[model samples]
Target: MGHDLDVLAARFGRHYPRWLLALLIISTMTMVLSSTSINVALPAIMQDFAIGRPLAQWLVTGVLAAMTSGLLLSSWAQARFGPRATLLTSFGLFLVTSLVAPFVTSIWALIAIRIVQGLCAGIAQPLSMVLIFRTYPGEGRGMALGLFGLGAMMAPALGPTLAGFLVDHFGWRAVFWLPAPVCILSLVGGALLLPTLRSLTPPRLDVPGFILLNLALFGILAALAEAQRFGWLHDATLLTGAVGLLGLAAFLWRCTHHSAPLLPLRLWRNASFRHTSWVSMVLGVSLFGVTYLVPLYVQTVEGYSASDAGLLLLPTGLVLGVAVFAGGWLSDKLAARWLLVGGLGLLTLSTAGQALMGTGASFWAICAWASLGRLGIGGIMPGVSTAAVQDLPAEELAPATGTISFMRQLGGALGINLLTFFIEWRHVAEGASAAGDAQAFVQSFWLLTALFALALWPAWLLRSKR
Candidate 1:
């Protein structure tokens, strides 16, 4: 069987790597679109479920949390089950989950399904990077990584526009149905196109490490989710935060001590990986923070409809997609440190501009600011990803990619929750007028600007050579 699979891979290898990359890109776009496109539909869902902003926010939080947990297992799954089987399984689950999503009646049920959907997505995300790096030559890998970044970045870019249209015309349930066709196509293509290569000796799954990591993630998110209502100093909130911190500490210790750990802590010994990981976390915060806030602000404060708000983001998304491809191409020739500095610098400016928006801010103004921020993000993504793994040996690639992906998602999960809390707090403090809501959002953007600024120093410290 192994020999047969090797022959199959050789046969496919003759066709060039582009075909395989196409399939992987489509699969990635489908899953990522599922994650971000839903934000445009949140207002509609809030109305239907009769829930507040905080509860509605869980739809995203649940998915991010699940995705974060799922990423930790991706490298292991690929090592144990082979990349081909793992991707096929994830795509199948994604298809099934999308089919079931439209029928969910309760908010909790929807969150549960979103979690499962996220898990499926998590399984596929890291493999997208691993497979691409494995297939493409080192000379061209930067361009390949950029193309992959385009798809990954474009999903969130285009997701809101698509979801907005669906939500406006067919309602929120339609948003859930969007990924169906893409999933079907990916599953079929993956079955035939994915390389079948398994680990020689399957690694042991770190059950205890997995448990501690999840505990930390869940506890931190839960604490933040409830902090708006419970008060920060409340016993429950403090207890949950403490538990999460303790779990994180224990997990770190285990990774250092265990012979076969869930995450290899030694990966951090490389300065490039360490700096890139920090930038990745801040990028995650900035990326998701803007994505979440923009639609909500436009809808609630500016009185734009779901479709209108979604449309507002279309131009920014389009610009970001193009910029990502260009950035990836540039990564091959330029030093990553300069790219990171420029990108983060622009991101900070764009975010600061967003903080200056008032209730009377025009649609074009919003579009301009968002496009600028996304352009910065596109530039940062490919460079950061390429830099993170450039120094690692072949064997460390899987874990390094998985670990980096995990950090970004972890930052996303926490960032969104933190932004939500800030929004809620500011809304209460400023009072509940349209202008006041806009002010609260402005305050949140300022906070994001600070984060973006903080990320720049580390990004500047990245290796100066390609």
Candidate 2:
């Protein structure tokens, strides 16, 4: 494979970057598609597994938590294993898990497999970003990452529709099967074209810090997931919350004091990166939060089928793909702070529109609202992502990319559970009528709108340093 790739590279030396981008995008897309495509399949999985929402919720949140932890591992993995080995290994693991998932006999087994899948995804994603950032010139990096973002976002945007169709016709298992072929292709591509960008002296993995971070993330998500069922003051919730907080504090302390920390704590000193990280976390709340909420609302409250719910967001996906490219192009031409603020404003408007929408709101109305939100996301991703690492030195690329991705996924995992808790709490408070369910969803959207509005402060702070 190495010899063949070398020959091919010599023949197409000038076009190497494009080929590399194409390979990375598709690989990353397969990983991201796996993440959100399962959202529509949640109902089916619940029914098949004879599980409640909170337990079934683990299938998603567990993966996000694992994925979030996996992001921090990218820099370490790249240093220890090199990029070629790391990317291929992650892709290979993802492929095996996707293949095995359909056959799991127990819900715990499936969730475990999915978490493994998420770990692989978490490792692969940020490395791809680092590679893209390295491959592109300064002038075109925004557009490059924008195109990369489009591929990543496109999967989540369109994945559910495909997943819904698969679930309706085949079964929930088909969603697991969906990424297998693409993952295989990615594996082959990585083996052939991936450069071995290893550190000169490999960094030792911080096993204790890694364990602490996962403990913190899973503890918090577990607490959030169960808080509505067990009161927030309940022992389980309180215990888990405390575990998460303490673990987080310990991990931060380790990052500050350890000789070779898992994360580069000093990266936070970059004011632009700090602002961008905040904006990214807040954006994840809206991005993944809405994706999880919308499908459940349409299917349960509005009496749509899974496929119907997925179809409603189909237009939004298409619009978002185009908007992301435009946003990337615009980032190169405009101040990133302006794009970030404008994007947040649009997201706030989109969620507010959804909040005010009644259960009887028309399909097109919902589509319009969803598309507006995605447009805002498209605008935000290119600007925020470009700003996060643009000013950092080359050596910080892996950790910087991993940190930004970590913040986003951390927000997403927690955000999804928090949104779920709100729905459950509101449903119980208002009684379980159809009206109550609809109102619960409406209230959740309002919560999202508020979060988006709150993000504008960080977005404003993303000004270019003189």
Candidate 3:
């Protein structure tokens, strides 16, 4: 019921060190930039291995899958190891992986290393939100996430630009090299800047439930990732998918009965948290799907450089920054319900416009529609973030934020991989190649628009506490 950060800050006094916050932001930016820096490197990766779209796509899916599985362990790790120790350990893992990734000869080896990198990277993702939850108050949570966003959002647009340049001039290895220093810096920052609040009362670990839920989530996502590569109609694919689904159902059912379940059924028991989380998931799906698809269209279809594709995305990123800040600031004062609705609606419209693009449509039109749809995402990002943090019990804030972030990551992983598959399938079904089929690109947007519509229900159903 009480404001968490205001209370903590008041206790720390006005002189609470600012560099700690700086470290958090810097570390977050570096970690994110490293992760995304690969988008532009995909072409190089494919060429190096002489692989196809599905295998190259797995480089991303594998990392996301690792992160998804890793999130389930964050709370437990933090509780046992403490925040700084956990963060530093994760950074160490990331540093090692990044340094080694570029030297591998085989695509399978690169992916194998990436899977390790994903587990390492996963540690940072949840803790960033958890830190803000622990350190900031209800009204202040928006400020924290906004500040966090400011530090990280640029990487999505910049990573490819930097990677493209690095690959064009130096090598793909340079792209991996870029983040290595950042990871070291994060380790240094984690040592000094991260807060040192020892867990006062650790939650009991539900080990059995944790294993069941984690395996189920891992199975389903892995199946989704592999489905596109292996024919979906194949007997093994159908059998594994059915088992994965059943496992997922069982995991959800078991969570309800466990005393301290991994997800905590109670978090979703809240009217707003439940709705907003679904919105977050749908938004994640739509956002990642588009992020992957658009860049590919520009670079592969239209034959632009990765740097240029990133530049094309600049307007959208800038507007997204504006929308996120505005939404967060307004969350405390305005009715967030309509804001959520309008955001999703605008997103749908923009995606719809993208779907109508012909083979020879104006290049600028791609930029316009992409920017428009993403602004909607920007508007909702902070609001959806605010929704859960605002109503939560002070103690549960960390877990809640971590869980929401995990959902977004999972959605991104699932959306991008699956949509890539869908785009290929639809093209093949039409007796076409994805490279030249403008209609295939349009069909890809159909899935994204449908996802935006799915987001609408959650945004509409979620009631603002204000």
Candidate 1, which segments miss by more than 4 Å at Cα? 2-6, 9-18, 133-144, 233-236, 269-272, 386-398
TM-score of each: 0.92, 0.91, 0.87
Model 3 bad stretches (over 4 Å): 1-16, 129-145, 269-271, 361-363, 386-400, 434-436
The candidate, 2 or 3, that scores higher on TM-score is 2
Tens-digit lDDT track for model 1 on 119-199?
888889888888887788576786777677778877876788899999989999999889999899998887777876688
Task: Identify the runs in model 2 with alpha carbons over 4 angstroms from their true place.
Answer: 1-8, 11-17, 133-144, 233-235, 269-271, 386-398, 462-466
Q: In candidate 3, where is summed lDDT lowest over 10 consecutive residues?
A: 1-10
> Candidate order by lDDT, highest to lowest?
1, 2, 3
lDDT of 3 by residue, 1-466 (tens): 0223444456557544344566677776666666566776777778888886777877777777677767788777777777777888888887887898878888888888777777766777667767776666465665666678776665565666677788777877788787788788888756645665557787777777766765666566656656766787776567667767877787788888876777777788788888888877877775566767777776666777767765676676676777777767766676667777888998899889988775555668988988887778776776777776767788978678777877887788878777778877777776776543556777888878888887888788776567
lDDT at residue 234 of model 2 (Cα atoms): 92
* Best of the candidates, TM-score: 1
Candidate 1: global Cα-lDDT?
0.84
lDDT of 2 by residue, 305-409 (tens): 888988887898898888888887788788888888889999999989988987789999999998999889878987777788877899987578667877888
Q: Judge candidate 3 against the unseen true structure and give its global Cα lDDT, from 0 to 1.
A: 0.73
Q: How should the candidates be ordered by TM-score, best one leading? A: 1, 2, 3
Model 2 deviation from native, Cα RMSD in Å: 2.7
Better of 1 and 3 by TM-score: 1
